[model samples]
Target: MVSLVPSLTEAVAETLPGTLVGATDWCSHPADLDVTRVGGTKNPAVDRILALAPDLVIANEEENRAPDLDALRAGGVEVLVTVVRDVPQAFRELARVLTACGARSRPRWLDEAEETWSAPAPARPRTTVVVPIWRRPWMVLGGDTFAGDVLDRLGFENLYGTHPERYPRVPLQDLVDASPGLVVLPDEPYRFTAADGPEAFPGLSCALVSGRHLTWYGPSLAEAPRVLAEALRAVRR
Candidate 1:
């Protein structure tokens, strides 16, 4: 199997080791993963992937480009494209993908991840938050996003959750004008840090979170709630 999505690569690698023969360069989890690199999520080397001749190629709608996937399909490779807009969809898709990979039973980690999100959230008022995934021209999590749903389940409301675009670019001044109660910054797609991102919002509280925990949907989902909640709490301290 080959995986174009990083999270899916981790999922398949953990569920059934030695199952993957090829994966994108961005597949970083399981740190010691040894597989043929097929370039990247957006621009996978189709020739390299075809040469690997994987039985299945796992990809996410958001992380991969359609043309690349089409090229793979045209090469007679079976492509399993997944759409995960929210947390529930993530679990459902993961299960489906694993089942397609020939798992006789659901993986234990997947079950644990489901249980983690199913538990009652600690009693805390929902704080309005703006999540920035990028800078230069600021971009934020808008509506129908897995990360936004994760935060919503954790007792936080995304300020731009009603926006039409999933990830929208807004001017810095406009983001500041929104006046969110807190700014949640994940360290991926842009690598926002304490010194870099927080200074943009002088008075607002900012939480520097793990991009993997905040955005990934594989084994990390099992620990994301605890990791993310601690990061949120740290800003309060």
Candidate 2:
């Protein structure tokens, strides 16, 4: 099997070790993972993937390109495409993928992750914020995104959750004008840092969070609530 999505790669590698023969270059978790690199998610090396001759390939709708997946299908490879717009969908898809990989039983970590999120939310009032995943042109988590849902569950209400675009590119001035109570920045897709992102919002509080914990929907989900809540609390302190 080969995985084009990083989170799915981690999930399969953990659930059914040694089953993955190839994975995209972006599959970074389980840091010691030593699999054949199949380029990237958006522009995967389809020829290299076909050369590996995987029986099945796993991909996410958002993380991978349709044309690349179609090319893999045209080459007679079975590709399992997953759609995950929110946390519940994440668990369902994870379970579905693992089951497809021939797991006789659900993985313990998946159960633990479900239990972790199923617990009641904290009593704190929701803090309205803007989550920026990229900069330069400036893009944010907008309407119906997994990351946005994750934050929503953590008491951080996304200011742009009603926007039509999933990841909207907004001008810097517009973000500032929104006047969000806080600005949540994840360290991926753009690698926002303390020095870089916080300066953009002079008066607003900024929370620098792990892109993996914030966005990934694999083994990391078990501990994401604690990891993200701590980041949010640290900024408030």
Candidate 3:
């Protein structure tokens, strides 16, 4: 099978190993992964994927374009497209994919992920935060996103979580005016770093976090709670 989504790719690679014959270049987990790099998730080489003659192709509704999946189906390739908007949805979809692959037992990481997030969050004062996923033209986490739900579980309320658009582009000044107590920056989607993102908001606290932990919904989910808590706790006010 070929995986078009990075998180799904890692899930497949970790759970089923050699079943992954091809993946996008951005599927960077399992560091020593050896597979044909079709291309990036946004612009995967459909012809190359076809050339690989994969029995199945896995994709996500958000990460991959519908046209590409249509083109693959046109070539008689079976595709499994998953829709994951929140943590629970991710678990259900992962289970569906793994079951479709004929696994007799569920992966241990799945159980660990469930347990890690299942426990009730400790009582704490909620911190209102601005989470930017991209820079340049500035886009932020808005309504109904997996990342927003994860942050909510960690006692951080997304400032724009109820915005009409899921990832709305807002002016930096507007974000500043929102008076968020903290600005949470993820390393992927824009690669925000200590130097790049923190300087944008001088007085407000900032936390540079792993994009995988913040966004990915596979094995990374198992460790995200602790990793995110550490980054958030280390916030400089």
Which window of ten consecutive residues has the lowest lDDT sum in model 3? Answer: 96-105
TM-score of each: 0.97, 0.98, 0.98
| TM-score of model 2 vs. true structure | 0.98
**Per-model RMSD to reference:** 1.2, 1.2, 0.9
Candidate 1 runs further than 4 Å off: none
Clashing pairs in 1: none
* Residue-level lDDT tens digits of model 1 in 118-190: 9876687889899999998899999999999999999998989999999999888888888888899899988
| Position 42, candidate 1: lDDT | 89
What lDDT tens digits, residue by residue, belong to model 2 across residues 34-104? Answer: 99999989999999999999889999999999999999999999999999999999999999999988889
What's the lDDT for all of these models? 0.92, 0.92, 0.92
- Candidate 1, run of 10 with poorest lDDT: 228-237
Q: What's model 1's lDDT at 237? A: 14
TM-score of 3: 0.98
